[model samples]
Target: MRLVTYRRSIEAEARLGVLVDDLVIDVATLGERAGSPLPSRMLDFIKLGPVAVSELGFLLKEAGGRWPVNGALPLAGVILLAPIPRPDKNVFGIGLNYIDHVAESAAALDTAPDLPKQPVIFSKPPTSVIAPGEPIVHRADITQQLDWEVELAAIIGTTAQRVTRENALSHVFGYTVLIDMSARDCRRAGQWIYSKGQDSYCPMGPCIVTADEIPDPQTLDLWLTVNGVEKQRNNTSHMLFKVDELIADISQGITLEPGDIIATGTPEGVGAGRNPQEWVWPGDVIEAEATGIGKLRHPVVAG
Candidate 1:
C-alpha cells in the first residue's frame, strides 16, 4: 500500500491515508466506518506499528471494494506531507555510494586525503525534511554552489541491533525517494554536518511503498531532473555498499530505532562534476524519482 499523510485543506490537520491509483482512502474514515477510531495523525499511526498496518489492511478488505469508489475522499483536494514527517532521529546518509560518485568525489578531494575505509556517514537534521512539491530554500548568500543528489532512502520499520545481512531486510519498512540537497561551499568549509543540516535540505516522499511491493531493492532505476533537464541518472545496482551491508554496518555499535531513515547515496552527474558547473538557483525546480517508489519534486527559492 502507498501510505500518505495529507490535509484536505491548508488549515486542516494532517490525516493518514492509503493511496490507491488516483484515490486516497482516509484510514481514519475507514476506521470510523468499521466502528473503531484511529488517530487522525500519521505520526500516531507510525507509532502504532505493524498492528495499525494490519488493522488498516483488514478494514480495506472488509469494505468489500466499495470504500475507494465512494468518491467521498478526493485525493486531488489534499496536500501531502512527508510520509513520516518528523522522524525520531537525524537522517543517516551515505556519501559516495555509487562508484562513479566515489570516483568524482575522490578526484575532487585534495590528493589522496585518507578516505574512511568504512562508509562515510553523516546525519541530516530532521527539520531539513520537506514534503514532495515543497519549496527548497536556496540560500544564495550562504551557499553559491547548491547541488542536487537523487538517492533511494530506506525507512526502518523496527528496532535493529547487530542484524546480519541475511536478516537485515526484514527490518526495513519500505523505500522512498530522497533528494539530498547540498550546499557545496559549506561542505568544503569544514565537516559535512553544517552543509547537510540546513533547513529544508532533505526533501522526501510522495508515499512510502511497503517492502513487499519491491521484490529487489538494489535493481531499481533512479534519476533526477532540474527544471525538466536530466541530471543524475543511475541504478541502485551500482551502489558500492548495498542496502543490507549499510544497515548491518551502521547498526553494529549504534542502535537503529524505528522511524530512522538511511539515504543510500546518489549516483554521478552532480553539478560540481561539470567542467562549467551548474548549481541550483532561485526559481529552479528539481524532480527526483525511483522505480516503484514515486516522484519527489521541490521548487528552489532564494532564502
Candidate 2:
C-alpha cells in the first residue's frame, strides 16, 4: 500500500488516503464504505500499530483480487503533503554514508575521503518539508549554489531505543523518496542547520510504501536528476552503513518514535562535486526516484 496525506485545497485539512493506479482512495471514505472508517491522518494511522498495516494489507489484497473502488479520487486533483507533514520531531539525517559521496565531498574540500567511523548525524527541522509538485525555492541571493540529494526516507513504525541491528527492520513502517534540497552558503560557514533547514528545502513523498514490500532496504536503487539530466545514480547497496545499522546507531541513546522520519544518506553525484559546479537555477525541475518507493519531482522557482 502506498499511503499518502493530502488535501483538496490549501485551506483544507490533511487527510489520509491510499494511492492506487494514480488514484487516491480516502481511507475515511473507504472506511465509511466498509462501515469502518480508518485513521484519518498519516501519523494517527501509523500510531494505530499493526492494525493500520493490516487494514492496508486488506485493501491491497482486495485491490489485487479486484478493487472495490467506490470513492476513489484521481491523484491529479489533490495536493500531496509529506507523508507526515509537521512531523512530531525534526528529521534525522546521515551525511556521507555512501563511500563515493564521501570521496567526492572530500575531493571538493581538497581533503582525504576518510570514512566516518560512525554515521554523521544531522537534522532538518519540520519547516523544511514541501510536498511533491511544490516548487523548491531557489534562494538566489542567499545561495546560488543550491544542491539536490535524492534519498530513501524511512518512516518509523514504533518506538525503538537500544534496538539491535537484527531487529531494526521490524520497527520500520515503510519508505519514501526524499530530496534533501540544499543551499551551500551556510554549510561553508559551518552552519548546516541554516543550509538545510530553510523552508521548502526538503521535498518528500509521492507516498509511503509498506516495509513489508521492500525485502531488503539496501538493495534498492535511488537517484537524482536536474531537469531531465541524470546526475546521481547509485544504489543503497553502496552505503558504508546500511539501514539496519543506521536504525540501531540512531536509537542507541535517542528514542525513535512512531511517525519519526530518518533519511538515509545520499549517494554520489551532487552539484558541489561537479567540475565547474552545477547549481540550481529558477525553472529547473529536480527529480528524486527510488526503485520501489516512487518518484518526487519539483521545480525550482526564484525566491
Candidate 3:
C-alpha cells in the first residue's frame, strides 16, 4: 500500500489516504465506512502499528477496491504533502554510508579514503521538510553552494531501542524518497546542522510504500536528476551499512519512535564530488526517485 498525506485544496486540511492506481483513497473516510475509523494524521495512523495496515487491507478488499464517491479523489487533483509533513522529531541522516560516496567526498575534501566503522548519523530539523513539487529555497545570501542528495528513507512503525540487527526490520513501517538538500559552503567546522537544517532543505515523499510490499529494502534502485540530466544513480545494495544495521546501531543509544525517519544516505554522484562542482541555483528542478516509492520533484527558487 502506498500511503500519503494530501489536501484537496490549498485551504483544506491535510488528509490521510492510500494511493491506488491513479486515485487517492481516503483512509479516514474508508475506515469510517467500515465502522473502524482511522486517524487523519500520518503520525497517528502510523502509531496504529501493523494491525492498522492489515485492517486497511481488509477494508479495501471488502470494497472490492472501489471506494465510495466521497472516499476517493483523482491523484492529480490533490496537493501531495510530505508523508508525515512535520516529523515528530528531526529526520536522522546517515552520511557517507555508500563506499563510493565516501571515496568521492574524501577526494573532494583532500582527506583519507576511510570507511566508517559504524553509521555516521546526522539530522535535518523538522522545519526543513517540504512536500513533493514544493520549492527548495536557494538562499544565496546564506550560502551559494546548494547541493542535493537523493536518499531512501525508512519510517519507523514502533518504538525501538537497543534492538538487534536481525529484529530491526520488524520496526519499519514503510519507505519513502527523501532529498537531503545541503548548503555546502555553510558547513561550520564539519557540523552539518547549519548546512542541512535550513528551512525547506528536505524534500520528501511522493508517497510511502508499506514495508510488506518491499521485504528486502536493500534491493531497490534510487536515482536523482537535476532538470533533465541524471546526476546520481545507484542501488541500495551498494550501501556500506544496510538499513537493518543502521536501525540497530542507532537504537543502541537513542530510541527510535513511530513516525521517525532514517534517510539511508546517498550515492557518489553529488554536486560537491563533481569535477567542476555543480550547484543548484534558482530555476533548477530536482527529481529524486526510489523503486516502490514514487518520485519527488521540487524546483529551486530564490529565497
Q: In lDDT terms, which candidate is top? A: 3
TM-scores vs. true structure, each candidate: 0.93, 0.94, 0.98
Worst 10 residues of 2 by lDDT: 62-71
lDDT of 3 by residue, 13-107 (tens): 99999988999999999998879988988899999999999999899889997787788999999999999899989999999999999998898
Give the candidates in order of TM-score, highest first.
Answer: 3, 2, 1
Tens digits of per-residue lDDT, candidate 2, 133-224, equal 89999877798688888998999998999999999999999999999877876585454778887999989998999888897998988978
For each candidate, C-alpha RMSD in Å?
2.1, 2.0, 0.9
Local accuracy by lDDT, each model: 0.85, 0.86, 0.94
> After superposition, which runs of candidate 1 have C-alpha atoms over 4 Å from their true positions?
68-72, 109-116, 188-190
Displacement of residue 73 (Cα, Å) in model 2 is 1.0
Model 3, TM vs. native: 0.98
Clashes of each: 0, 0, 0
Enumerate residue pairs that collide in model 2. none
Q: Name the best candidate (by TM-score).
A: 3
Model 2, CA-based lDDT: 0.86
Name model 2 segments beyond 4 Å from true: 59-70, 110-112
